[model samples]
Target: MPAPRIKSPALLVAESGADREGHGLRRTLGRFQLVCFGIGAIVGTGIFVGLSDSVAQAGPAVVVSFVLAAVTCVFTAFAFAELGGAIPVSGSSYSFAYAGLGETTAFLVGWCLLLEYGVSVSAVAVGWSQYVDELLHSLTGLNLPHALAAGPGDGGVVNLPAVIVIALASVLLVRGVRESARATAAMAVLKIAVLVAFCAIGFVAFQDGNLSPFSPAGLGGIGAGTTAAFFSYIGFDAITTAGEEARDPRRDIPFAILVCIGVVTLLYCAVALAAIGALGGDGVGDRPAALSHVVNEVTGSAVGGGVIAFGAVVAIASVVLAVMYGQTRILMSMSRDGLVPRVFEKVSPRTATPVAGTLIVGVVFAVPAAFASLDSVVNLCTIGTLATMVTVNIAVIALRRREPDLARTFRVPLYPATPLLGIGFCLYLIYETGPATWFQFAVFLAAGLLLYAGYGRRNSRLGRGGDQGLTPGDAGRVRQEA
Candidate 1:
């Protein structure tokens, strides 16, 4: 009657068990696969292509920026881990908000996730195309025509390689979660190995003078570099999106998240140090394939560069696969609650995946990857992710207060302080995005709210009195399923 503001944690838990007969997503992912998934998603375009820009912003002090960004993510990751264990659902932060915040707030969080995961898939795919062209030229001394190699805004007819990579990732997702996990695991290993090799080669040429006057632009430059580096950490939280599909989500999701943050942080710092030490900030320049360029410069061999380019290709592809998987699952959760079309909720019994939803995401995002410039949209993605993370941090506090005795496998060490810091850090990063990014994010939120008012509010399952029979006690009984 009052606009279905909230859904009790118990009801959400009970509803998760509705697929006991196996019509929903299958729980084939374990701790190892989830770790790989997080790694696969986190170590892509940001390191391969975006590092040069961060170096330019802060000189050699980009290493410190990497640490600062990781610290911000660590705070939010703790909040995510705590809630992820308590409410293991595919909707992730959206579902957490629905239970602790309200239906409208949940819809908005889901809308933000659309920007974080859906647009991210296209953005990563576009980055992948550059590496593909690099690798092709290295191997065959030939390259894709400009018209087929870049988005129209980049002076091309269409980005054919970007579309192809998205299509490939979508097909893997439609086949089944287990198959996708295996492919991701393989690529994850390859990419990590490649990064390790690059670090090794770069360190051989390390010179102390290259790292001198590290904070060339002082605090201001470091802060800007941190903002640039923060985008590299975008996919670590994606581990929680596998809640329904994790074999023991309550345990595995949190573990995978923490491990992912640690692994990615160490790798990023190592790569940043090695690149800056070997060539200095000026040498890194502003190249699209920064990592490969560094390796070539250090060794004076195109072969080394070619290998790094191949790794970037694999790394970006894995991000596309893992992030696209997260996007479809979130949409499926939204559809289940009648906030979107029912087609998204349909699962293929044979594959045990959301076939329709995955395909739709692939097609919708690929168009932007093919035809539009993503320079501005990348900032939009960063803002959307930060906003949702702020919601997640608050949702952690709300759920703790609302469900005081709810069984939780993991708990934030400092309770209110941790989530509070997470919120502050997220908001600060959001502020650093500048006025133009804020305007774009405001428009995105306005469109989302308009859609919710027009359709989602009326059709929500809770608004239809569908939760009448569910009670708080039901949560304890269905804890394992959740």
Candidate 2:
């Protein structure tokens, strides 16, 4: 039999090593842009839409759930920062797996990420509909028709606004990365300002009685809530997907990752506290629009609710932009490796953007946002993310052993402890995702394996021995000085 193929770490490094000096895509992002990407990716639906579900699950102790999720994210974020600094590639966990494990493992990670980012974009798009409908109702005294404003499960024939927003984001991304980053930064500022306004106003109306029976469902409830709240932290890894575009991938990627996680964690904890305190946990759950409901309840005014609804609409757009951006870049990376079609890897000479990939991603998620119920997509994303987390932590440890001499801009503290705990926490969350999710995930994995067998394994660049170990290329003129 022919030797079983495995993508060596050297090959993985060579692929990203070619990223310097404008090998394929344009490098336009700085550290601030990177931080905004994470913030934009993270602070949307989970707070504006999903918070109510978490509140319902844990009562007032949803605060504990947010904290638990943040702590877990911190562990995984450290591992990601370390790996991203070393490899500095667009594939995020997929690239990390390819370097530390094998090609098969890398393909599996990429497959999981495809679902994670694509469904997340759709889920956030569906979330945007909630706020858009609320804003319209507040201003025009008319709600969008159920058939046009919601998915079938939510009693609507289709979600028109969700599809519209995805289409708009696709146009923006096709324009270029700098343009997308600028828009993301502007929206990030607007959403953060709105969230601050909410906290400020909510504190004035805070009621102590609302916190009574804080852990209404006990520890089990808090654990369950953490599973949902964890979704809030999903986009921090999107920062790592910009390694090729980053001005200084090693130093900036790690810094941006840590900053985004720290800032978002604090914001989430505060928002959870303010929301439960102002509206009461029970009052917040299942509300058609959670943040708007909180503002309306506390201020006794519809204007504040209207303002919040507008901010949420913008926030969800930023999320769609950031998440879709991450997805397309990951597809591009896989394509360059010959794991997928070369069309995905094609960059427009004029725009330096992946036009085909961006359009395809937009269309793929748009269909789901237009018709499918996405409550399941959120859980599916969490399951995929936990799996990525497990691989990332292991990749960190493996890289340390394999490349002791590699220059690292950041390292996970306490060595094996951080990654080990990261693995343990990810597994715990996987268990909490329930049996139904596992079955769905298994189906998804099986589909990915079939695709790999049919196409990827044969066409992979490593299989053909092309630039597998950093052979001189156009990008070799200006090497990164480590």
Candidate 3:
């Protein structure tokens, strides 16, 4: 359906109230830094923790899954580039829906965004715990007890490291965005470096035979693998949320989205292929193993794997930083619109960061990380991101028709065809996720809808969307409309 062009007062993107203008977060990050953030977010979990699940779901066919998943994202990535360029705001899909699809859709999109960034942050925390435990056991021959290190799914009492990581990231977010991004970029380099080293070491031990029987379950297996593989791709989209803060939204943002995805995909494929090569099929190396296990098996030395485990620890911190930063930004956008409570939008006067929102979101992630099943939450995160991408694809088409003359700095190529392909890819993955994911998503959306109707609808600036308050660009747009 074509979305209505929303000239709503609520849609005037509020200042990222924390930063100073111009030199502020508004277009401050360059392409390289933006790409690093994307990599920082993408390279961690999908490689370190998610690989086992990808193997379980798709077996040797996971390589196929990676390709399929990357294909799907490439389509959606194009649409995101276009939309991110047009709107260039922090809300990501929420802001996109506001301008192109109106307040209600914007509300729901914001809710889904919450699911994508928030739950994913929790999931990353769970992943963080696993690596921390791995590092401890290998280095010190002593580790946190199983209860404190593992999640419910793993029959552990709690994931304390996960909680701690969340807490630490919260502090950084409260510090500020640019500061957090720099820290995350440094950690991201370490994570990639570790993985690259592992890949190089394992590559020498590669056996060509492992490539045989690649598609054990054929396309079905590969499809499942692709869906599973897609989980790692989540962080690349989060980079789009930095649109408002980017130095050049029209050029840099699109490059970041695509370039980041490309970089991560290559890394994942290399890591997966290298791991499989170093360990034979049905080997203990392929069992319910952390990434360190694969490294250990190939090297015949636990020390190398121990280093990989340490690398995993660094990777998790990077993941938490990128994911938490995305979460706070989206919430800031929501708070500004009065959809969520207003206090969340408050920026720290000193750091110019949304300290309150960061703390709240940090605590929210901590709960699940401290107590919930990592595997289960990971699935939830997958569904939320896929669902949002579907919305982005739909919104891309809707906006093009509704505002034909709107200055789109970057447009999705091949007319509607590219985004339509993106929509199809997104839906297939959504279906591939099957019923349980759908059920959870339904409950999440329903709950969000209830909140929207009860609070957001009444308080929405759209209903009385008369120029109440606006900055210069926003005021100009309003006057032009009037």
Tens-digit per-residue lDDT, 370-453, candidate 3: 888766877777888888888888888887887676556677889788988988988988898889889999999999999998
Q: Using alpha carbons, what is the TM-score of model 3?
A: 0.93
**For model 1, what is the C-alpha lDDT against the true structure?**
0.88
Query: RMSD of candidate 3 to the true fold?
Result: 3.2
Residue runs of model 2 more than 4 Å from their true location after superposition: 1-10, 16-19, 472-481
The most accurate candidate by TM-score is 1
TM-score for each predicted model, relative to the true structure: 0.97, 0.96, 0.93
Total clashes for model 2? 0
Error at 425, model 3, angstroms: 0.7
lDDT of 2: 0.87
Per-model lDDT:
0.88, 0.87, 0.77
Query: Could you tell me which residue pairs clash in candidate 1?
Result: none
Ranking the candidates on TM-score from highest down gives 1, 2, 3
Ranking by lDDT: 1, 2, 3
In candidate 1, what are the lDDT values of residues 1-482, reduced to their tens digit?
66547987667757766324353778899999999999998999889878987898889999999998998999999988988888778888888889888999999999999888989888888889999998988788898998999987889999999999999999999999999999999999999999999999989999999998889999999988888888889888788888888888888889999999999999999999999899989988477788888888888878898999999999999999999988998898899899999999999989998898999999999999998765646788989999999999998888788788776788898878888998888888888888999998999999999999999988988888776676555655655443
lDDT score at residue 481, model 1, on the 0-100 scale:
40
Better of 2 and 3 by lDDT: 2
